[model samples]
Target: MSRRRFTIRRPRGVAEYGAAALVAAAAVSLVVRLLVWVGEVLVRWWPVVAVLALLGIAVGAWRAAAAAREHTARAQRLSVLRFTLAEIDAMDDRQFEFALRDLLIRDGWSARQVGQQGDQAADVIAGHPTYGRIVVQAKHTKVAAKVGSQVMYQVKGTAGPVHRANSAVVVTNGSFTRDAREWGDRHTIGWADRERLRSWAELGVPLHQILQLPTLARRRLPGTRQPFPAPYERTAPEGRTNGVR
Candidate 1:
C-alpha cells in the first residue's frame, strides 16, 4: 500500500480572505475568457469589485481599532479608580473629612466643620454662603461599618432653622442601612453614600477647602511657616495650658 501526504491551509481573516476571493474571481473570469468570450464581462466589472473589496477591508480595520481603543481606555479608568480607593483607605478620619469638605467648597458651597464639642449635630455644615445651609455628617468608617437611622435622625434634628437652611446631607465611606435611606427619603435629607464619595474622589475633587469657615480665626505660630494654620488645630498658644504652664 502507498501512503499519501496532504497539507491543509488555515482560514484567513476577513480582509485577507476577501482579497484572496477578489483575486481568485478575477483570475477565473480571465481564464473563462481564454476558453470563451465571457472574460470581457468580468474584466469590465473588475474595477468596481476591487474598489468594493478595499472599502470592506478599510471598514473592518476601522472597527477593530475603535474596539481596541475603547478597551484600553476602560482599563485606564479602572486603574485610576483602584489608586483612588487605596488613597481613601489610607487617610485618617481628619484627612477624610478635610478631603470631603474641600470637595464641597470646590463645588461652590461654603462649609464648616461643626466641632463635636459644641451642641453641633453634624460634622459639617455647607451652604450657598448667601442662600442657605446644608448639614453634612461625614462618616469615616471601615467597609464593615454602616450608617444607621439614628445618625440620620441626629443630622435632621440639628439642621438649624428652616428659614436659614433648606436641607441636610449625610456623607459616609460605608453604605447606609435601608432603614436609614428610607428615613432620609421620608425626611427629605440628601444621602451621599459610599459610591457617590468614591465618584467625587475619582473626579479629583478637593475635600479640605470645605472646612474653611469664615467665622473661624486664622492663626500662625512658631514651627509653622505659613501665615495661617489649619483651623482644626488647638487654639491655645504654645506652652500655655488652661491652668498649667
Candidate 2:
C-alpha cells in the first residue's frame, strides 16, 4: 500500500513574471511595428491605389451607362422599327441573327444573338416565362434558296443537348426544302420558313402561336424521332442542292 503526496504550484518568481512581461511587451512591440510598416506601405502606394480605384469605378460606371443606353435604344427600335423581308434579306448573316433576337425581345422574351464562328448552331437564344427556352438557327439566304436538312440536324443535335433549350427551331427568310421540313418534323424540330418569319417578324405574331409545339408548353421538349411524311423523295449532291446549309 502506498500513499501519493500531491503538491500545488503557484507562479514561480519575479524572473518568470519578468519573462512573461517581456513576451507580452515584445508581442505589443511587434504589433506596433507591423502597423507602422503597413501605414508606410499605404502612404507610399496611396496614389497608385487611388488611381486604380478611380479607374475601376469610372470603367464600371461607363459600362453600366453604355449598357443602359443600348437597352433603351433596343427597346425603342423594337417598338418603332419596321422589319420587312427586304430589310431582312439585305442583312448579313450576323445582322439576320440580330433581327431574330430583336423579334424575340419584341415578343416579351429575353433574347440574344449568339451566332458567331463557333456558335454551336444557336444563332439566337431566347427565354420566356411561360414558354421556356428556345434556340434558333438563322439561315439567311435568297428567296429562291431553301434551308436544307443539315441545318435542322445541327439545331436539333445541339439545341436540346448542348444549349439546354426547350425548343429547337431553324428560322430562315427563305423556305425549307421538302427533305428539310420532313426531317425537322420527324425530329420535333420547328421550322420558321419565309411565311412563318413574315408572321413573327412582320405581322407581330407571337412565336408560340406560329410554331406547333408540344401541348405541354412548360415542359422540356423531348428529343425523339417521330414519324413525319417525306414526300417526293429525292436526293441531291451536298454542294449542288439549291439550299443553304
Measured by lDDT, the strongest candidate is 2
lDDT of 2 by residue, 124-206 (tens): 77777677778888889999898888888888889878888888889898998999999988888999999988877766666
Report the Cα RMSD per candidate: 15.5, 20.5
lDDT of candidates 1 onward, in order: 0.60, 0.75
Clashes in each model (backbone N, CA, C under 3 Å)? Answer: 10, 0
Off by over 4 Å in 1: 1-83, 129-131, 162-164, 204-245
**Which candidate's TM-score is highest?**
2
Which residue pairs show collisions in model 2? none
TM-score of 2: 0.55
